[model samples]
Target: MVFEEGRIKQWLINYINPGMAFNDIKSVVTHYTALHPTKETYIFNDGTPMELVNLQGTIPVTYKSVVYNIPIIIWLMDTHPQHAPLCYVKPTPTMNIKVSKYVDQNGKIYLPYLHEWAQDKSELLGLVQVMIVTFSEQPPVFAKVKPKEALYHPSINNSFPNSVFMQQPPYPTHSPYPQPSYQGMMPQAAQSGYPPGGYPLYPTPYPAYPPQPSSMINTGTGTIKEEHIKESLLTAIEEKLMRRMKEEFQQNQAELDTLKRTQDELKQGSLKLQVVLERLEKEKSDLDKNITVLKDKEQELDKAIERLSNQESMDVDDAVITTAPLYKQLLNAFAEEAALEDAIYYMGEALRSGVIDLEVFLRQVRTLSRKQFMLRALMQKCRQKAGLTVV
Candidate 1:
């Protein structure tokens, strides 16, 4: 919206005094308008209207007599109800005032009086008119405030007072106590009994009237007065306390929700760890059973070798070997079994012949045999599963 004098003044007042009433300023004018044939007129205020000098033709109005020359003239146009008034200012020769010209270090014309003239009220008014013309040449700054229906519905135009168009209502003033209510549409004032718009005729119900003393006047009498306590401040404090409590409750609830989520995550992690531990224990048990079966096979092979050592010849009869197929089967089961036994026998003979240390040879033979036997058994299982018989 285009800035009006009233709006500008209000902004200035707000800048100067935050809470003071701006309407008390008598010199400040609003919606000021002037025309050419009438010269200059202060239509709204009771002050004397200023005289206007007509420039024979268009000329520029300068601060002093002149550094530059131009023309000034004013144009009049009818004002529309929904639109701001239209005016124009064209430059004229007579309006220009020439001053002593001076150039600084830079080649620029300097006119002291011309600068002062630009600030003059008459010159400012002319500038405002020029701005209006310039703006009209371009697009409108704002859409019309009134709707199209207002134009067709004549009653809508008169529904609100003219003051509503010029001035905005004061923002709802906050009060410590609840605003007093009346039976009908009109708002009731407080104990002051003054209605809106500065009217004081309305009667309002008083919530805390002073109590009368019972004692009457006798030959001599005394009067006593009681003080009434105001509860407005207390009410305001209570409202603030309630608001703070509500905010604290919401913060606490958010913390509780976050804690609950963290707890649920920890529970899920614990359950996953439990499942992993159970699977690891089962795998450890299966490995132990395989180790026990290997130990039993090794013990049976040791007994058979001891019996062969006691015989007069190293070879056993085929009939005697055939009577126990289990022994023969076990011997032929793993491909590396004969090599493992031969290594063990050679280590034992070397210790007996003093070629190696007895304790060292026995330890090496036991370790080598255990590892080779386990590996050979694994290889035999793989060969059998692939349908290849041992040679």
Candidate 2:
């Protein structure tokens, strides 16, 4: 008896989705039917009992009780000839007609066969007419009774009832039914028509009393009328309405206050966001300036490298013409230099291996010495530009 509204809503959602196939519908119906048994008759708005009758169909369905013939319509929607054929007991001949196709202004197409046959008035018109005719022909029966009057009264004497009085009740010859006892004189007055042990054949009719005046007069005073109470009731109702209006106004004011608070919060949030965005823009400008400075420094370093390369090329030409003894001395000096120690050692090994001539080896040594001098000068210039003393 306690239906879960949420569960039914979920079922409806599943049913209406276009993606749900026939099998899904069948399963959903089966589950619903299991929860709601068929033995119980579901009454429709028209007071008709619905019995579930499963018609033979491609889709396996068990007929549950139908209420207001709704199950028949449901079965038709499930399995029609165009989609899936459904067979039912006592199938009407008029139901064989194919349903009409209806399309909405939205261009949504609904095949007549897709809808229930009962839903189509044109299709079920004759059937409904036939049903109405049959029902009218055999109307339900109701009981009727007429009031009887007492014509002649009969008397019964218990004292002489054995032979003389037993032939019949003494002459006025009323029915032999016993009379009911009266409240004040029960044993003597039995004219009320109910017997001692038997129930009354007819209920006693109540005597009608004359209506009283609407206004009542107080002792030696003016009359008090219902109008006073009516006026008071109306006044109370007006006061209640005024109170309700005041309460509604208060509620409206509270709602407006809440809305104003929300608006204030939103405005504050927007202002904060604007402030953050401005700060971000400033940071972005600063980063762009830093990037430009780094690019300039890179350009300066490239020019310095080009100058050192040209100077080294000139130094190598001069060293090639110099004496070999002077070259050897320069080599020993280059080996002792901390910065060029690794270069000197590798060059010495190459010369010893006969990979290069003495002239080429002397030139390379001179080029390396000039490059080291240029690098040291560049480092000192960089330190001076940065306002740092070179050690």
lDDT of each: 0.37, 0.37
**Candidate 1 residue-wise lDDT, 1-391, digit = tens:** 1324454344333233312212211111122222112112212123323222111122222222221212222211111111122122221111111111121111112222222232113232433334334333321111122434333433234444332222211112222212211111111235224455322231222122111111221112222122211233354456556645654675687689899999999999999999999999999999999999999999999999998789776445443453354444554545366677778888888999999997799689879878886867766765565556854
Clashing pairs for predicted structure model 2, backbone only: 50-66, 50-67, 51-65, 51-66, 52-64, 52-65, 52-66, 54-63, 180-194
Evaluated against the true structure, the overall lDDT of model 2 is 0.37
Q: How far in Å is the alpha carbon of 55 misplaced in model 1?
A: 50
Task: List TM-score per model, in order.
Answer: 0.25, 0.26
> In model 2, what lDDT does residue 265 have?
100
